[model samples]
Structures are given as C-alpha cells and as structure tokens.
Target chain A: MFGLIGRMRASPGKRDELVALLLDGTEAMPGCLSYVVARDPVDADTIWITEVWTDEQSHKASLDLPRVQATIAKARPIIAGFDSQTRTEPVGGVGL
Target chain B: MFGLIGRMRASPGKRDELVALLLDGTEAMPGCLSYVVARDPVDADTIWITEVWTDEQSHKASLDLPRVQATIAKARPIIAGFDSQTRTEPVGGVGL
Candidate 1:
C-alpha cells in the first residue's frame, strides 16, 4: 500500500474551515483505505493529514478526480502553505 | 487521543536499519494505540512515522521509559535529522 503524510498550515484562523473542506473532500474517494485529518494541538494553524491508498497510481488518480480538484480549488486560498509532505510505502498495520 | 506525525531522514543507506530499530522499539509500549513506520517511496533515505497514544501525557511518558531511551540512543546516530513533526489530536478513525 502507499501512504502519504503531509503537514499543511491553514491561513490564520482558518484551521477549522480547512479541516471541514478536507473532511468533505474524503467522501467517495475511491481506493482510499484510510484518510485522516487531525488538528495540531500545539500549533493551532497547522494540520496533519495521513492517507493510505491501494497504490501510488490510485493516489495520483485521485488528484485528478473532479471532486478532488474542486476541493483543492476551494481549499487553495484558505491554505497558508504546506510545511512538509512525504510519500511512503506502507509495510503493514493493524487498521490496514 | 493524541497523534504524532514525524518525518525522519536516515543517514545514507541506513533507512532499513532505522526502520528495524523503530519496529523493535514498539514492543511493550504502554498506552500506544498505533505505531506505523513506513518507507518513503520517492526518497530512499526518508521515513515517516505515525503514532497514536491514549493521551498527550502517555506519549510524553513513553519518551522517558528505559526501552525508549535505549532505542533513541541506538537509533540516534543512524538518523540524519528530523524534517518535520506535528502533534495532533485524533478525533476518530477506523483503527482506534
């Protein structure tokens, strides 16, 4: 399986709004095993997203979907910037 | 629950060894809900670690444990540096 761990900073007080957009975007995401959006307890403006997909291709494909594209368009302005993003190959896990 | 998402870059060619140590370190960790270590598919020397604990205090306490201290000591030299770390509050998920 493929995994993605990304840290995104919301613009000022837009953290909750960004999280809502993220949670909304997860709907009907094909090939998604798990997609979690969590709040950064220490940094109010930052959020962490952890995703598991069937494969690298599936993840890439999702980016092109209309739903995803629309979500990104909506979330672009609210996003301050991405701090870090790492692509990972998941070995195994309990939830997966 | 508390969550930790961290990215670590290993010394050149030591990614696998570091991953081994991380996996070994998970044994008998009290209050640990989930601990997953994954290889970076794009970057050979990087690894992503996603951890969940009962609470923030439990996560902090794990750092002081003998086993954890020993693991940190053993793994320190192999680690190149940490790229990013975000402390998160997990709302709900499939695994936990």
Candidate 2:
C-alpha cells in the first residue's frame, strides 16, 4: 500500500486553477488510484492533496510520464512548498 | 483497494476538538491504512478527511467498534454533514 499526503500552498490568485489542473492530472495518471484536491475553507490559497498509488514502483514510474512532469512544472511557481510524507502499509496488515 | 473520502463540518467552536478526536481515532483503527485530517485555511469550521482501509469488510467492521461508534455519536452534532464517496479499484489496477 503506497500513499502520500501533500500540503500545498497556492499563489494568492491562482489556487482555483491549480486545483483544476491537479484534478485533471489525476484523471490522466495511469497508476493513480485516488487523487483528491481540497481547499482551506478560510484560506483559499491553501491546498490539500490525498494521493494513493498501486505500489512504490508504480508511483515512482508515474513521475516519468511527460504529462505528469509537465503538470508539475506548471505548478512549481504557484506552489508554496510541497510538504508531503510518503508511507506504506506493511504487507499482510490489511488488504495487502 | 478500498477507500473512502469523507467531508466533515465542525460546529462553530468545535472544529479543533473534532480534529483531535479523529486523529486519535485513526491511531486506534485496526484496518486503517491512512487516516488524514485537513483544515480549510479560511473557514476554520471546515474539515477534510482522507481515509483508506484494507478492504470494505474491515471498513464495515470499524464502524461497529465501540470506540468508533462512540466517536461517531460524539461527533454527530458537531458534524455539519458527511459528504463522502465510497469507491474501489478494480482488481489488477496497479498494486492490486
């Protein structure tokens, strides 16, 4: 089980567009299981993402895709910091 | 893979408390894979939760646990609404 929770801060005026791109990117990812985008109710510039991947290898492979890389590049300037933690579920623990 | 994304609304002043309880609850869940809590930067009263489970059965079982049930009861009033979509990954999709 591979997962990551990323906290992103968007440029003051570009938050909504970032969210749209992320949602679109999620739909484009071949290995992505879940790609959720959320906004802070109070601070619209704050963004939250819940990402789920099939496994570490697949997740790693996803980084090489052209569209995925492009989307990331487009977001670099608008993003504050990619505060994320990557973790895994030990085999046999749950669905594994 | 089994996953659920639930949106919770906190009472005017109870948002923080709800986050604490939910975080604690995640630590206690037997089949939980990922338990995440996020706050809307602006609203203060808004909350977002990202939940992952081993499978649907484990998730169902979790709801039957005493502590889990109690937590739900304790949170019903403070919760504005639970807007969650339950979904699954077809077998052979990535890690499956």
Q: Estimate each model's TM-score.
A: 0.71, 0.49
Can you tell me the DockQ of model 2?
A: 0.08
Error of 1 at A16 (Å): 1.4
Interface RMSD of each: 2.5, 10.0
The whole-model lDDT of each prediction reads 0.83, 0.62
Q: What CAPRI grade goes to candidate 2?
A: incorrect
* Candidate 2: segments with Cα more than 4 A from true spot: A84-96, B1-96
Error of 1 at A61 (Å): 3.6
Clashing pairs in 1: none
- Candidate 1 chain A has its poorest 10 consecutive residues by lDDT at A87-96
* lDDT (Cα, tens digit) per residue for candidate 2, span B21-71: 766554567766655566655566776566666677888998888887888
Q: Write one digit per residue (lDDT tens) for candidate 2, span A1-78.
A: 466655578887898788777665545566566555666555657765666665768778888888778888887888
Q: What fraction of the native alpha-carbon contacts across the interface, defined at 8 angstroms, is recovered by model 1?
A: 0.44
Clashes of each: 0, 8
Model 2 TM-score, 2 decimals: 0.49
- True-vs-predicted CA distance for residue B96, candidate 1, Å: 4.1
**What is candidate 1's CA lDDT for residue A43?**
94
Q: Evaluate model 1: give its TM-score.
A: 0.71
